[model samples]
Target: MGEHAAVAAVDDPVTVDRIAANLRELGVEAGDTLLVHTSLSELGWVAGGPQAVVDALQRVVTADGTLVMPTHSTQYSDPSVWSNPPVPDDWIPQIRESMPPFRPELTPSRGMGAVAECFRDYPETVRSRHPLYSFAAWGADAESIVADHSFENAMGEASPLARVYDRDGSVLLLGADHASNTSLHLAEYRADLDTGRVTETAPVLRDDERTMVEWTDIEHDSGDFPQVGAAFEKAHPEAVRQDDVGTATAKLVDQPALVDFGAEWMSDHR
Candidate 1:
């Protein structure tokens, strides 16, 4: 092999390895349970995109340590259920392509349930039963929520999540408020918004599984109801359009985390 080829392969593996090691040093020991919300593109193109990231992470936090992320498929929500309007059908196919596969064993809750299928393995640990205010919402007024979504009463009886959130061992924030949360079952935490009394939706589901989940967050940290700096996509100028995630990846080592999942996560999220 040419000296250059040898150097490239050697260097690349080293980089991926270093990335993994760095995460370990970030207090991610074998027993540490981690719940991460990441933008893969933010990390630049590592050796293998999301797969590489997961592989590296798994290396540090082994069998005992659990890794979680949001695999939210908010777009998957049935159009009939949307409060504002439907995302154009033509755009959906494109949107799906951009979405990574929800590999729960590996990625856990990345994208906040943008990839719901990944968490199918651990349904009990990752779901909320409230017809509204149900998706991983904690410390909520259960009686009020249960009464509104009568079906919820049935689901909650079987729900292992309601009590978990009450204990504050849960991580209710998907990192995105109302509009972006794929964890909509928890929207019931807020009263008027919980009933569809605030915002109405009539979306249908495929079988009993929800093709779409409805959400109305009049009270959350998202601020200004439906306006955020990142929501409205700007028209990209011609030439080359680079997304920010790749840049984000390289920058992660230096940035302090917006959220950290310590031992308390289990106690809070459970």
Candidate 2:
């Protein structure tokens, strides 16, 4: 949505304090480890935009809590897998060779939105090492949540998703649906499905030098995520808390329950 339209849609400016209050009402508590997925535009006109949203999250969660968000840089992956405006076949090798290595501190996340991009650069925020599916985190356990992000199985056991699961974290979907719920990928890893592996290459910094590394990992698909989420919500309605944060619909989910249910659901159906 455009700026003028967004401004016209809201009766009052959505301030940081307002967003924080909305988040608190949505079950976000102090010291809770939360993984957030948000749409800045969906929240309508705001007094401070993405930064205000981030600030509100921090205010609710506090420094004792942990905050996480996907900072994926799919553009750093193999050009062969590129379909959204795919490059020429001859240019693949050239792009790979010339592409800068993924630097957690420098490489900007692609398609992760303004809020995430801002969160990544926030003070004390640390990002994982996965070139394609890195996650940025802040507050307590920030380093541990993003630590040891394996090159293979970027969203599986060794990934930050698992760390969040270990911490009994919750997921906050601000104007995003189950399709954007990345925790389901952890279920895909555990579910009894033949998610075949694909060999992918990415440029990484090795001893402060650029080097191309290859790994094989399960090919993730989100086509069934929305359906799985709907079923889960139906089966466990009480676990999914729905409310309004700003002008956008928000949902606070129990991560472990959803992942457990998702694993069983995908195993039986898919």
Candidate 3:
């Protein structure tokens, strides 16, 4: 069956209360800082859709807890490297010149899904300033977490993922898998596994002028994230918890534990 057909087969509308309850069952607490990676469709047609999912997360985390999601604008990067439906070589300069500067309020997420897009639209959310690797956060500690995302190390020790790791936060995989677990990128940095570096350029609004800037950042590779995650689960089963949120499977894992295990695993395996 096709993806939409499978979803239609379930057709059960999930509500805010139900989502919140399921989150609680997945080990989310009242004052937890959660980095969520979600697939809205897997939640079985939420009543209010992405907004309802965001509300449910907020309800569970409450005002004291912080919520975070990757709002990366990958399209903001250099057009010269575009591969999927790549523009003609002659158009690279034109595209770069015309590319709009990254705006926290207006720049839309490319592939982060409906839930993250909705969360980014949240009025109280604070987004990182990085043009390509921005992250949106809300609630307590949000500002401190996303305030300084280093352009040179987008997912390294200088990024929001580092703060989440240092704060002993949790990762909530709501119908998403290890591939979407961005925290793993931190382990790649920690492992110092020679993932290489890539020089990327983007347009940014600086002093009311759109300026094109270039920076060399560590090339983050998630090719083995699934394998690493499987190894992590095997090594630290106690730190990982699983449950259901709506019809979607949910995983709650200790960020620090995963990173620690992942660093070690990558060092030995990668």
Candidate maximizing lDDT? 2
Say which candidate scores most in TM-score. 2
> Which residue pairs collide, candidate 3?
none
Q: What TM-score, over all chains together, does every model reach?
A: 0.41, 0.99, 0.96
- lDDT-based ranking: 2, 3, 1
Candidates' RMSD to native: 13.0, 0.7, 1.5
C-alpha local distance difference test of each model: 0.33, 0.94, 0.89
Model 2 superposed RMSD (Cα): 0.7
Worst 10 residues of 3 by lDDT: 1-10
Q: Candidate 1: global Cα-lDDT?
A: 0.33
> Tens digits of per-residue lDDT for model 2 on 1-270?
779988998999999999999999999999999999999999989899999999999999999999999999999877886899988999998998899999999999999889999999999999999999999999999999999999998999999999999999999999889998999999999999987889988999999999988988998998999999999999999889999998899999999999999999999998
- What clash pairs does model 2 have? none
Say which prediction, candidate 2 or candidate 3, comes out ahead on lDDT: 2
Give the per-residue Cα lDDT of candidate 1 at 254.
8
Ranked by TM-score, top first: 2, 3, 1
- Residue-level lDDT of model 3, residues 148-238, one tens digit each, is 7888988888889999988899999999999989999999888948677899888888899998788898777899999989888888899
